[model samples]
Target: MTQAVAADLPIWAALPVALLLLLGAGLALTGTLGLLRLGSFYERVHAPTLGTTLGIGCVLIASMLYFSVLQTRPVLHEVLIAVFMTVTTPVTLMLLARAALYRDRREGNDQVPPPPPPPRGGQEEGPDGTTEEMAAMDRAELAERR
Candidate 1:
Protein backbone atom coordinates (compact mmCIF):
# COMPACT_ATOMS: atom_id res chain seq x y z
CA MET A 1 0.00 0.00 0.00
CA THR A 2 1.16 3.57 -0.66
CA GLN A 3 2.18 5.34 2.53
CA ALA A 4 1.93 9.02 3.41
CA VAL A 5 5.11 11.03 2.82
CA ALA A 6 7.25 12.03 5.81
CA ALA A 7 6.55 15.72 4.97
CA ASP A 8 2.94 15.16 6.00
CA LEU A 9 4.00 14.38 9.60
CA PRO A 10 3.93 17.47 11.85
CA ILE A 11 6.86 18.49 14.08
CA TRP A 12 4.84 17.72 17.23
CA ALA A 13 4.20 14.08 16.31
CA ALA A 14 7.51 13.45 14.53
CA LEU A 15 9.79 14.42 17.42
CA PRO A 16 8.21 12.21 20.11
CA VAL A 17 7.91 9.23 17.78
CA ALA A 18 11.55 9.52 16.86
CA LEU A 19 12.59 9.78 20.52
CA LEU A 20 10.40 6.88 21.60
CA LEU A 21 11.75 4.59 18.85
CA LEU A 22 15.29 5.43 19.87
CA LEU A 23 14.54 4.84 23.56
CA GLY A 24 12.84 1.55 22.77
CA ALA A 25 15.72 0.33 20.63
CA GLY A 26 18.23 1.25 23.33
CA LEU A 27 16.33 -0.61 26.03
CA ALA A 28 16.06 -3.72 23.85
CA LEU A 29 19.79 -3.60 23.12
CA THR A 30 20.59 -3.28 26.82
CA GLY A 31 18.48 -6.31 27.61
CA THR A 32 20.16 -8.32 24.90
CA LEU A 33 23.58 -7.44 26.29
CA GLY A 34 22.49 -8.32 29.82
CA LEU A 35 21.24 -11.72 28.72
CA LEU A 36 24.60 -12.48 27.12
CA ARG A 37 26.77 -11.17 29.97
CA LEU A 38 24.95 -12.42 33.09
CA GLY A 39 26.42 -15.56 34.68
CA SER A 40 23.46 -17.26 36.31
CA PHE A 41 20.07 -18.44 35.02
CA TYR A 42 18.10 -16.42 37.58
CA GLU A 43 20.06 -13.27 36.82
CA ARG A 44 19.81 -13.81 33.08
CA VAL A 45 16.01 -14.06 33.08
CA HIS A 46 15.49 -10.62 34.63
CA ALA A 47 17.20 -8.47 32.02
CA PRO A 48 15.18 -9.54 28.97
CA THR A 49 11.88 -9.38 30.84
CA LEU A 50 12.42 -5.79 31.93
CA GLY A 51 14.04 -4.75 28.70
CA THR A 52 11.50 -6.25 26.29
CA THR A 53 8.51 -5.04 28.29
CA LEU A 54 9.73 -1.47 28.50
CA GLY A 55 11.15 -1.48 25.01
CA ILE A 56 7.94 -2.78 23.47
CA GLY A 57 5.93 -0.32 25.49
CA CYS A 58 7.95 2.62 24.18
CA VAL A 59 7.81 1.40 20.59
CA LEU A 60 4.09 0.72 20.82
CA ILE A 61 3.37 4.13 22.29
CA ALA A 62 5.30 5.68 19.44
CA SER A 63 3.30 3.66 16.92
CA MET A 64 0.02 4.69 18.57
CA LEU A 65 0.96 8.36 18.43
CA TYR A 66 2.17 8.26 14.83
CA PHE A 67 -0.83 6.40 13.44
CA SER A 68 -3.35 8.28 15.54
CA VAL A 69 -2.02 11.63 14.33
CA LEU A 70 -1.59 10.55 10.71
CA GLN A 71 -5.10 9.08 10.50
CA THR A 72 -6.78 11.70 12.70
CA ARG A 73 -8.38 8.88 14.69
CA PRO A 74 -7.29 6.85 17.71
CA VAL A 75 -5.15 3.83 16.80
CA LEU A 76 -5.35 1.10 19.44
CA HIS A 77 -3.97 -2.20 18.09
CA GLU A 78 -0.80 -1.64 20.10
CA VAL A 79 -2.83 -1.64 23.28
CA LEU A 80 -3.79 -5.29 22.89
CA ILE A 81 -0.21 -6.32 22.11
CA ALA A 82 1.01 -4.32 25.11
CA VAL A 83 -1.58 -5.83 27.42
CA PHE A 84 -0.76 -9.43 26.41
CA MET A 85 2.97 -8.80 26.70
CA THR A 86 2.70 -7.04 30.10
CA VAL A 87 0.66 -9.87 31.53
CA THR A 88 2.67 -12.78 30.11
CA THR A 89 6.35 -11.78 30.34
CA PRO A 90 6.71 -11.80 34.13
CA VAL A 91 4.55 -14.88 34.45
CA THR A 92 6.79 -16.74 31.99
CA LEU A 93 9.80 -15.55 33.97
CA MET A 94 8.37 -16.90 37.22
CA LEU A 95 7.47 -20.24 35.68
CA LEU A 96 10.95 -20.64 34.15
CA ALA A 97 12.67 -19.65 37.41
CA ARG A 98 10.57 -22.03 39.49
CA ALA A 99 11.17 -24.88 37.10
CA ALA A 100 14.91 -24.24 37.11
CA LEU A 101 14.95 -24.01 40.91
CA TYR A 102 13.06 -27.26 41.24
CA ARG A 103 15.37 -29.04 38.80
CA ASP A 104 18.51 -27.75 40.47
CA ARG A 105 17.29 -28.70 43.92
CA ARG A 106 16.16 -32.14 42.81
CA GLU A 107 19.56 -32.78 41.26
CA GLY A 108 21.27 -31.73 44.49
CA ASN A 109 23.00 -28.69 43.12
CA ASP A 110 25.07 -27.16 45.93
CA GLN A 111 24.51 -23.59 44.68
CA VAL A 112 20.79 -23.69 45.38
CA PRO A 113 19.66 -22.65 48.85
CA PRO A 114 18.05 -25.19 51.16
CA PRO A 115 14.27 -25.39 51.25
CA PRO A 116 12.64 -23.33 53.99
CA PRO A 117 11.76 -25.20 57.16
CA PRO A 118 8.22 -26.51 57.27
CA PRO A 119 5.52 -24.93 59.44
CA ARG A 120 5.53 -25.70 63.15
CA GLY A 121 3.07 -25.48 66.03
CA GLY A 122 3.94 -23.12 68.91
CA GLN A 123 7.45 -24.37 69.81
CA GLU A 124 7.85 -27.66 68.05
CA GLU A 125 11.26 -28.59 66.70
CA GLY A 126 11.61 -28.59 62.93
CA PRO A 127 12.92 -31.58 61.01
CA ASP A 128 16.27 -29.82 60.77
CA GLY A 129 16.43 -29.80 64.64
CA THR A 130 15.85 -26.05 64.98
CA THR A 131 12.70 -24.72 66.58
CA GLU A 132 10.39 -22.22 64.87
CA GLU A 133 11.53 -19.53 67.31
CA MET A 134 15.29 -19.62 67.63
CA ALA A 135 15.41 -16.34 69.55
CA ALA A 136 13.80 -17.96 72.64
CA MET A 137 16.38 -20.75 72.77
CA ASP A 138 19.55 -20.36 74.85
CA ARG A 139 22.96 -20.27 73.22
CA ALA A 140 23.98 -23.59 74.76
CA GLU A 141 20.80 -25.32 73.52
CA LEU A 142 21.25 -23.79 70.07
CA ALA A 143 24.84 -24.99 69.97
CA GLU A 144 23.74 -28.44 71.07
CA ARG A 145 21.33 -28.68 68.14
CA ARG A 146 24.13 -27.81 65.78
Candidate 2:
Protein backbone atom coordinates (compact mmCIF):
# COMPACT_ATOMS: atom_id res chain seq x y z
CA MET A 1 0.00 0.00 0.00
CA THR A 2 1.17 3.54 -0.76
CA GLN A 3 2.29 5.76 2.13
CA ALA A 4 -0.15 8.45 1.02
CA VAL A 5 -3.07 6.02 1.18
CA ALA A 6 -1.98 4.77 4.60
CA ALA A 7 -1.71 8.34 5.86
CA ASP A 8 -5.22 9.17 4.71
CA LEU A 9 -6.79 6.49 6.91
CA PRO A 10 -6.44 7.85 10.43
CA ILE A 11 -7.95 6.28 13.56
CA TRP A 12 -11.15 8.28 13.11
CA ALA A 13 -11.69 6.99 9.58
CA ALA A 14 -10.79 3.42 10.53
CA LEU A 15 -13.20 3.48 13.48
CA PRO A 16 -16.31 3.41 11.31
CA VAL A 17 -14.98 0.56 9.19
CA ALA A 18 -14.16 -1.51 12.27
CA LEU A 19 -17.54 -0.88 13.82
CA LEU A 20 -19.34 -1.64 10.59
CA LEU A 21 -17.48 -4.88 9.99
CA LEU A 22 -18.21 -6.10 13.51
CA LEU A 23 -21.86 -5.07 13.37
CA GLY A 24 -22.32 -6.69 9.99
CA ALA A 25 -20.79 -9.92 11.17
CA GLY A 26 -22.97 -10.01 14.28
CA LEU A 27 -26.15 -9.40 12.29
CA ALA A 28 -25.25 -12.11 9.78
CA LEU A 29 -24.60 -14.56 12.58
CA THR A 30 -27.89 -13.71 14.23
CA GLY A 31 -29.74 -14.23 10.98
CA THR A 32 -28.14 -17.62 10.49
CA LEU A 33 -29.06 -18.64 14.00
CA GLY A 34 -32.62 -17.51 13.48
CA LEU A 35 -32.79 -19.48 10.25
CA LEU A 36 -31.72 -22.61 12.09
CA ARG A 37 -33.92 -22.14 15.16
CA LEU A 38 -37.12 -21.08 13.41
CA GLY A 39 -39.60 -23.90 13.02
CA SER A 40 -41.52 -22.97 9.86
CA PHE A 41 -40.55 -22.39 6.25
CA TYR A 42 -41.83 -18.80 6.14
CA GLU A 43 -39.91 -17.77 9.21
CA ARG A 44 -36.77 -19.50 7.98
CA VAL A 45 -36.98 -17.80 4.59
CA HIS A 46 -37.43 -14.37 6.13
CA ALA A 47 -34.57 -14.65 8.60
CA PRO A 48 -31.76 -14.34 6.09
CA THR A 49 -33.00 -10.94 4.97
CA LEU A 50 -31.50 -9.51 8.14
CA GLY A 51 -28.13 -10.45 6.74
CA THR A 52 -28.98 -9.38 3.22
CA THR A 53 -30.30 -5.94 4.10
CA LEU A 54 -28.79 -4.46 7.25
CA GLY A 55 -25.78 -6.73 7.54
CA ILE A 56 -24.64 -6.28 3.97
CA GLY A 57 -25.46 -2.61 4.24
CA CYS A 58 -23.05 -2.03 7.11
CA VAL A 59 -20.25 -4.04 5.51
CA LEU A 60 -20.75 -2.35 2.15
CA ILE A 61 -20.70 1.13 3.65
CA ALA A 62 -17.49 0.26 5.42
CA SER A 63 -15.98 -0.99 2.17
CA MET A 64 -17.06 2.14 0.35
CA LEU A 65 -15.52 4.36 3.00
CA TYR A 66 -12.25 2.42 3.12
CA PHE A 67 -11.84 2.29 -0.65
CA SER A 68 -12.76 5.93 -1.11
CA VAL A 69 -10.13 6.97 1.40
CA LEU A 70 -7.52 4.69 -0.14
CA GLN A 71 -8.20 5.74 -3.72
CA THR A 72 -8.65 9.39 -2.84
CA ARG A 73 -11.99 9.33 -4.65
CA PRO A 74 -15.60 8.32 -3.99
CA VAL A 75 -16.05 4.57 -4.31
CA LEU A 76 -19.59 3.81 -5.44
CA HIS A 77 -19.28 0.17 -6.46
CA GLU A 78 -20.28 -0.98 -3.01
CA VAL A 79 -23.38 1.17 -3.21
CA LEU A 80 -24.44 -0.61 -6.37
CA ILE A 81 -23.65 -3.93 -4.77
CA ALA A 82 -25.79 -3.11 -1.74
CA VAL A 83 -28.66 -1.95 -3.90
CA PHE A 84 -28.50 -5.07 -6.06
CA MET A 85 -28.51 -7.28 -2.97
CA THR A 86 -31.50 -5.52 -1.40
CA VAL A 87 -33.57 -5.92 -4.56
CA THR A 88 -32.63 -9.53 -5.23
CA THR A 89 -32.81 -11.14 -1.79
CA PRO A 90 -36.58 -11.04 -1.24
CA VAL A 91 -37.33 -12.02 -4.84
CA THR A 92 -34.92 -14.92 -4.61
CA LEU A 93 -36.48 -16.09 -1.36
CA MET A 94 -39.97 -15.98 -2.82
CA LEU A 95 -38.96 -17.92 -5.92
CA LEU A 96 -37.28 -20.59 -3.88
CA ALA A 97 -40.23 -20.96 -1.53
CA ARG A 98 -42.64 -21.08 -4.45
CA ALA A 99 -40.60 -23.78 -6.17
CA ALA A 100 -40.44 -25.79 -2.99
CA LEU A 101 -44.21 -25.50 -2.56
CA TYR A 102 -44.74 -26.57 -6.17
CA ARG A 103 -42.55 -29.60 -5.69
CA ASP A 104 -44.35 -30.52 -2.49
CA ARG A 105 -47.75 -30.13 -4.13
CA ARG A 106 -46.71 -32.16 -7.16
CA GLU A 107 -45.79 -34.98 -4.82
CA GLY A 108 -49.29 -34.81 -3.29
CA ASN A 109 -47.90 -33.67 0.04
CA ASP A 110 -50.28 -31.92 2.40
CA GLN A 111 -47.79 -29.23 3.31
CA VAL A 112 -49.93 -26.47 1.92
CA PRO A 113 -53.66 -25.85 2.08
CA PRO A 114 -55.73 -27.60 -0.58
CA PRO A 115 -57.70 -25.66 -3.18
CA PRO A 116 -61.21 -24.66 -2.10
CA PRO A 117 -64.07 -26.88 -3.23
CA PRO A 118 -65.94 -25.83 -6.38
CA PRO A 119 -68.97 -23.61 -5.90
CA ARG A 120 -72.38 -25.24 -5.90
CA GLY A 121 -75.26 -23.80 -7.94
CA GLY A 122 -77.83 -22.23 -5.59
CA GLN A 123 -79.99 -19.13 -5.18
CA GLU A 124 -77.74 -16.19 -4.39
CA GLU A 125 -78.36 -15.05 -0.83
CA GLY A 126 -77.09 -12.19 1.29
CA PRO A 127 -75.16 -12.53 4.58
CA ASP A 128 -78.46 -12.77 6.49
CA GLY A 129 -79.19 -16.23 5.02
CA THR A 130 -78.69 -19.12 7.42
CA THR A 131 -76.88 -22.38 6.69
CA GLU A 132 -80.14 -24.36 6.61
CA GLU A 133 -81.64 -21.87 4.10
CA MET A 134 -78.60 -22.21 1.86
CA ALA A 135 -78.80 -25.99 2.03
CA ALA A 136 -82.49 -25.95 1.15
CA MET A 137 -81.95 -23.54 -1.70
CA ASP A 138 -79.09 -25.65 -3.03
CA ARG A 139 -81.25 -28.78 -2.80
CA ALA A 140 -84.06 -27.10 -4.73
CA GLU A 141 -81.62 -25.97 -7.41
CA LEU A 142 -80.16 -29.46 -7.68
CA ALA A 143 -83.64 -31.01 -7.99
CA GLU A 144 -84.55 -28.49 -10.68
CA ARG A 145 -81.37 -29.24 -12.61
CA ARG A 146 -82.08 -32.98 -12.42
Candidate 3:
Protein backbone atom coordinates (compact mmCIF):
# COMPACT_ATOMS: atom_id res chain seq x y z
CA MET A 1 0.00 0.00 0.00
CA THR A 2 2.82 2.42 0.90
CA GLN A 3 4.66 1.36 -2.23
CA ALA A 4 1.63 2.21 -4.38
CA VAL A 5 1.25 5.56 -2.63
CA ALA A 6 4.90 6.40 -3.15
CA ALA A 7 4.77 5.27 -6.75
CA ASP A 8 1.71 7.37 -7.39
CA LEU A 9 3.52 10.55 -6.36
CA PRO A 10 4.11 12.92 -9.26
CA ILE A 11 7.31 12.00 -11.09
CA TRP A 12 7.12 14.82 -13.61
CA ALA A 13 8.84 17.21 -11.20
CA ALA A 14 11.95 15.06 -11.37
CA LEU A 15 12.74 16.50 -14.74
CA PRO A 16 13.14 20.04 -13.45
CA VAL A 17 14.89 18.90 -10.30
CA ALA A 18 17.39 16.81 -12.25
CA LEU A 19 18.01 19.67 -14.64
CA LEU A 20 18.73 22.03 -11.77
CA LEU A 21 21.16 19.56 -10.22
CA LEU A 22 22.91 19.12 -13.54
CA LEU A 23 23.19 22.88 -13.92
CA GLY A 24 24.75 23.16 -10.50
CA ALA A 25 27.20 20.36 -11.29
CA GLY A 26 28.20 22.02 -14.53
CA LEU A 27 28.81 25.33 -12.76
CA ALA A 28 30.97 23.67 -10.14
CA LEU A 29 32.95 21.87 -12.85
CA THR A 30 33.59 25.09 -14.70
CA GLY A 31 34.66 26.82 -11.51
CA THR A 32 37.13 24.04 -10.75
CA LEU A 33 38.51 24.28 -14.25
CA GLY A 34 38.94 28.04 -13.84
CA LEU A 35 40.81 27.51 -10.59
CA LEU A 36 43.28 25.24 -12.37
CA ARG A 37 43.61 27.25 -15.56
CA LEU A 38 44.17 30.67 -14.03
CA GLY A 39 47.71 31.97 -13.84
CA SER A 40 47.88 33.69 -10.45
CA PHE A 41 46.49 33.31 -6.95
CA TYR A 42 44.41 36.45 -7.32
CA GLU A 43 42.98 35.28 -10.62
CA ARG A 44 42.30 31.82 -9.25
CA VAL A 45 40.34 33.23 -6.34
CA HIS A 46 37.61 34.44 -8.67
CA ALA A 47 36.94 30.91 -9.97
CA PRO A 48 35.67 29.55 -6.67
CA THR A 49 33.51 32.61 -6.26
CA LEU A 50 31.46 31.47 -9.22
CA GLY A 51 30.89 28.04 -7.74
CA THR A 52 30.21 29.39 -4.30
CA THR A 53 27.70 31.83 -5.74
CA LEU A 54 25.86 30.41 -8.75
CA GLY A 55 26.63 26.72 -8.31
CA ILE A 56 25.33 26.69 -4.78
CA GLY A 57 22.43 28.84 -5.86
CA CYS A 58 21.23 26.18 -8.30
CA VAL A 59 21.61 23.42 -5.75
CA LEU A 60 19.67 25.40 -3.17
CA ILE A 61 16.95 26.09 -5.66
CA ALA A 62 16.71 22.39 -6.43
CA SER A 63 16.54 21.54 -2.76
CA MET A 64 13.79 24.05 -2.20
CA LEU A 65 11.82 22.70 -5.14
CA TYR A 66 12.22 19.04 -4.23
CA PHE A 67 11.43 19.47 -0.55
CA SER A 68 8.50 21.75 -1.18
CA VAL A 69 6.99 19.32 -3.64
CA LEU A 70 7.56 16.22 -1.54
CA GLN A 71 6.32 17.72 1.68
CA THR A 72 3.54 19.76 0.06
CA ARG A 73 4.77 22.83 1.96
CA PRO A 74 7.13 25.70 1.20
CA VAL A 75 10.63 24.86 2.41
CA LEU A 76 12.69 28.03 2.91
CA HIS A 77 15.52 27.15 5.25
CA GLU A 78 17.75 26.46 2.28
CA VAL A 79 17.00 29.94 1.02
CA LEU A 80 18.27 31.50 4.22
CA ILE A 81 21.46 29.45 4.12
CA ALA A 82 22.00 30.33 0.48
CA VAL A 83 21.56 34.01 1.24
CA PHE A 84 23.96 33.84 4.14
CA MET A 85 26.58 32.00 2.10
CA THR A 86 26.34 34.44 -0.76
CA VAL A 87 26.80 37.35 1.59
CA THR A 88 29.65 35.87 3.60
CA THR A 89 31.69 34.15 0.91
CA PRO A 90 32.80 37.36 -0.74
CA VAL A 91 33.75 38.92 2.59
CA THR A 92 35.79 35.86 3.48
CA LEU A 93 37.47 35.86 0.09
CA MET A 94 38.33 39.55 0.43
CA LEU A 95 39.88 38.99 3.85
CA LEU A 96 41.90 36.03 2.58
CA ALA A 97 43.16 38.00 -0.40
CA ARG A 98 44.19 40.88 1.83
CA ALA A 99 45.97 38.51 4.21
CA ALA A 100 47.81 36.91 1.31
CA LEU A 101 48.84 40.35 0.05
CA TYR A 102 50.06 41.32 3.50
CA ARG A 103 52.07 38.11 3.91
CA ASP A 104 53.55 38.38 0.45
CA ARG A 105 54.54 41.99 1.06
CA ARG A 106 56.02 41.12 4.43
CA GLU A 107 58.04 38.34 2.81
CA GLY A 108 59.30 40.83 0.19
CA ASN A 109 58.01 38.62 -2.57
CA ASP A 110 58.46 39.92 -6.13
CA GLN A 111 55.01 38.72 -7.24
CA VAL A 112 53.35 41.62 -5.41
CA PRO A 113 54.11 45.32 -5.56
CA PRO A 114 56.80 46.57 -3.20
CA PRO A 115 55.90 48.86 -0.36
CA PRO A 116 56.45 52.61 -0.76
CA PRO A 117 59.95 53.89 -0.18
CA PRO A 118 60.71 55.28 3.28
CA PRO A 119 60.35 59.02 3.91
CA ARG A 120 63.10 61.42 2.81
CA GLY A 121 65.64 63.50 4.88
CA GLY A 122 67.80 60.39 5.34
CA GLN A 123 65.59 59.63 8.44
CA GLU A 124 63.90 61.91 10.88
CA GLU A 125 65.89 62.55 14.04
CA GLY A 126 64.30 62.42 17.46
CA PRO A 127 64.92 64.74 20.41
CA ASP A 128 67.48 62.26 21.66
CA GLY A 129 69.47 62.57 18.37
CA THR A 130 68.41 59.06 17.33
CA THR A 131 66.66 58.57 13.99
CA GLU A 132 62.91 57.98 14.22
CA GLU A 133 63.06 55.82 11.08
CA MET A 134 65.24 53.34 12.95
CA ALA A 135 62.65 53.18 15.72
CA ALA A 136 60.05 51.64 13.35
CA MET A 137 61.32 48.95 11.02
CA ASP A 138 60.01 48.23 7.52
CA ARG A 139 58.05 45.01 7.59
CA ALA A 140 59.82 43.42 4.63
CA GLU A 141 63.25 44.53 5.78
CA LEU A 142 62.55 43.32 9.31
CA ALA A 143 61.58 39.90 7.96
CA GLU A 144 64.78 39.82 5.90
CA ARG A 145 66.82 40.88 8.92
CA ARG A 146 65.54 37.89 10.84
Candidate 4:
Protein backbone atom coordinates (compact mmCIF):
# COMPACT_ATOMS: atom_id res chain seq x y z
CA MET A 1 0.00 0.00 0.00
CA THR A 2 1.24 3.51 -0.80
CA GLN A 3 1.92 5.62 2.31
CA ALA A 4 0.30 9.02 2.74
CA VAL A 5 2.75 11.91 3.00
CA ALA A 6 2.59 14.51 5.77
CA ALA A 7 1.44 17.24 3.35
CA ASP A 8 -1.52 15.13 2.30
CA LEU A 9 -2.87 14.70 5.84
CA PRO A 10 -6.01 16.69 6.81
CA ILE A 11 -5.40 19.66 9.13
CA TRP A 12 -7.28 18.02 11.98
CA ALA A 13 -4.74 15.18 12.19
CA ALA A 14 -1.66 17.15 11.19
CA LEU A 15 -1.85 19.80 13.89
CA PRO A 16 -1.79 17.42 16.86
CA VAL A 17 0.99 15.37 15.32
CA ALA A 18 3.08 18.46 14.79
CA LEU A 19 2.40 19.73 18.30
CA LEU A 20 3.31 16.42 19.87
CA LEU A 21 6.55 16.20 17.89
CA LEU A 22 7.55 19.67 19.01
CA LEU A 23 6.68 18.94 22.63
CA GLY A 24 8.66 15.73 22.53
CA ALA A 25 11.68 17.50 21.12
CA GLY A 26 11.44 20.16 23.80
CA LEU A 27 11.24 17.62 26.62
CA ALA A 28 14.17 15.65 25.26
CA LEU A 29 16.20 18.83 25.01
CA THR A 30 15.39 19.77 28.60
CA GLY A 31 16.62 16.39 29.76
CA THR A 32 19.85 16.78 27.84
CA LEU A 33 20.44 20.13 29.53
CA GLY A 34 19.72 18.66 32.93
CA LEU A 35 22.21 15.88 32.38
CA LEU A 36 24.86 18.40 31.50
CA ARG A 37 24.03 20.95 34.24
CA LEU A 38 23.39 18.84 37.34
CA GLY A 39 26.32 18.64 39.77
CA SER A 40 26.02 15.26 41.38
CA PHE A 41 25.51 11.76 39.98
CA TYR A 42 22.47 11.22 42.21
CA GLU A 43 20.88 14.48 41.10
CA ARG A 44 21.82 14.00 37.48
CA VAL A 45 20.37 10.53 37.01
CA HIS A 46 16.80 11.67 37.56
CA ALA A 47 16.49 14.30 34.85
CA PRO A 48 17.14 12.12 31.82
CA THR A 49 14.97 9.32 33.14
CA LEU A 50 11.93 11.56 33.51
CA GLY A 51 12.65 13.63 30.44
CA THR A 52 13.34 10.80 28.00
CA THR A 53 10.37 8.74 29.17
CA LEU A 54 7.87 11.56 28.79
CA GLY A 55 9.51 12.96 25.70
CA ILE A 56 9.61 9.64 23.91
CA GLY A 57 6.05 8.99 24.91
CA CYS A 58 4.94 12.18 23.20
CA VAL A 59 6.91 11.45 20.04
CA LEU A 60 5.72 7.87 19.85
CA ILE A 61 2.12 8.88 20.38
CA ALA A 62 2.49 11.37 17.56
CA SER A 63 3.96 8.74 15.28
CA MET A 64 1.19 6.33 16.18
CA LEU A 65 -1.46 8.94 15.49
CA TYR A 66 0.07 10.11 12.20
CA PHE A 67 0.60 6.63 10.86
CA SER A 68 -2.76 5.35 12.01
CA VAL A 69 -4.40 8.15 10.11
CA LEU A 70 -2.20 7.67 7.07
CA GLN A 71 -2.93 3.97 6.87
CA THR A 72 -6.48 4.19 8.19
CA ARG A 73 -5.62 1.59 10.80
CA PRO A 74 -4.40 1.66 14.40
CA VAL A 75 -0.60 1.51 14.27
CA LEU A 76 0.71 -0.01 17.50
CA HIS A 77 4.43 -0.68 17.19
CA GLU A 78 5.09 2.33 19.37
CA VAL A 79 3.39 0.65 22.28
CA LEU A 80 6.03 -2.06 22.38
CA ILE A 81 8.82 0.52 22.28
CA ALA A 82 7.18 2.52 25.07
CA VAL A 83 6.78 -0.52 27.27
CA PHE A 84 10.39 -1.56 26.75
CA MET A 85 11.66 1.86 27.72
CA THR A 86 9.39 2.12 30.77
CA VAL A 87 10.59 -1.22 32.02
CA THR A 88 14.31 -0.64 31.46
CA THR A 89 14.89 2.97 32.50
CA PRO A 90 14.06 2.60 36.22
CA VAL A 91 15.97 -0.63 36.51
CA THR A 92 19.00 1.05 34.96
CA LEU A 93 18.68 4.02 37.33
CA MET A 94 18.63 1.75 40.37
CA LEU A 95 21.61 -0.23 39.17
CA LEU A 96 23.66 2.89 38.49
CA ALA A 97 22.70 4.36 41.91
CA ARG A 98 23.74 1.20 43.73
CA ALA A 99 27.01 1.00 41.82
CA ALA A 100 27.86 4.62 42.53
CA LEU A 101 27.01 4.24 46.21
CA TYR A 102 29.20 1.18 46.44
CA ARG A 103 32.13 2.87 44.76
CA ASP A 104 31.79 6.00 46.92
CA ARG A 105 31.66 4.01 50.15
CA ARG A 106 34.60 1.89 49.11
CA GLU A 107 36.66 5.05 48.61
CA GLY A 108 35.57 6.26 52.11
CA ASN A 109 33.56 9.17 50.87
CA ASP A 110 31.99 11.05 53.79
CA GLN A 111 28.83 12.03 51.92
CA VAL A 112 27.27 8.59 52.03
CA PRO A 113 26.29 7.02 55.36
CA PRO A 114 28.58 4.36 56.86
CA PRO A 115 27.67 0.73 56.63
CA PRO A 116 25.53 -0.61 59.48
CA PRO A 117 27.29 -2.70 62.14
CA PRO A 118 26.91 -6.46 62.31
CA PRO A 119 24.09 -7.82 64.45
CA ARG A 120 25.10 -8.74 68.00
CA GLY A 121 23.50 -11.61 69.89
CA GLY A 122 21.58 -10.89 73.14
CA GLN A 123 22.56 -7.24 73.23
CA GLU A 124 20.30 -5.17 75.41
CA GLU A 125 18.23 -2.77 73.38
CA GLY A 126 18.24 0.90 74.28
CA PRO A 127 15.08 2.59 75.59
CA ASP A 128 14.14 3.34 71.99
CA GLY A 129 14.29 -0.40 71.29
CA THR A 130 17.04 0.13 68.78
CA THR A 131 20.76 -0.53 68.70
CA GLU A 132 21.46 3.06 67.74
CA GLU A 133 22.74 4.00 71.19
CA MET A 134 24.85 0.85 71.45
CA ALA A 135 26.44 1.52 68.11
CA ALA A 136 27.18 5.10 69.14
CA MET A 137 28.65 3.91 72.39
CA ASP A 138 30.80 1.37 70.63
CA ARG A 139 32.05 3.99 68.20
CA ALA A 140 32.85 6.32 71.08
CA GLU A 141 34.78 3.60 72.90
CA LEU A 142 36.77 2.80 69.79
CA ALA A 143 37.65 6.45 69.39
CA GLU A 144 38.75 6.74 73.01
CA ARG A 145 40.86 3.61 72.73
CA ARG A 146 42.70 5.08 69.80
State which candidate, 2 or 3, has the greater lDDT.
2
Best by TM-score: 4
lDDT of 1 by residue, 1-146 (tens): 99866657889999999999999989999999999999998888888865679999999999999999988999999999999998988788889999999999999998989765544454565567655346554444556558
Judging by TM-score, tell me the better candidate of 2 and 3: 3
Report every candidate's CA lDDT: 0.84, 0.83, 0.82, 0.86
TM-score of 2: 0.68
Write the number of the candidate with greater lDDT, choosing between 1 and 3: 1
Q: Write the per-residue lDDT of candidate 3 for residues 1-146, one digit (tens) a residue.
A: 35443423366777777889999989999999999999999899999877888999998998898888888999899989898997899899999999989999999889998765655555455767544455554544566457
Worst 10 residues of 1 by lDDT: 131-140
List the candidate 3 regions with Cα displacement exceeding 4 Å. Answer: 1-12, 115-146
lDDT by residue (tens digit), candidate 2, 43-142: 7888888988999999999999898887889989987888789888879888999887777778888867764444565556767989888788767767
For candidate 1, give the lDDT of residue 5. Answer: 64
List where candidate 2 sits over 4 angstroms from the true fold: 1-8, 108-111, 116-146
Regions of model 4 farther than 4 Å from truth: 1-7, 119-146
lDDT of 3: 0.82
Compare the candidates by lDDT and give the number of the best one.
4
Which scores better on TM-score, 2 or 4?
A: 4
Decoy 1 TM-score against native: 0.75
At residue 67, candidate 3 shows an lDDT of 84
Worst 10 residues of 4 by lDDT: 116-125
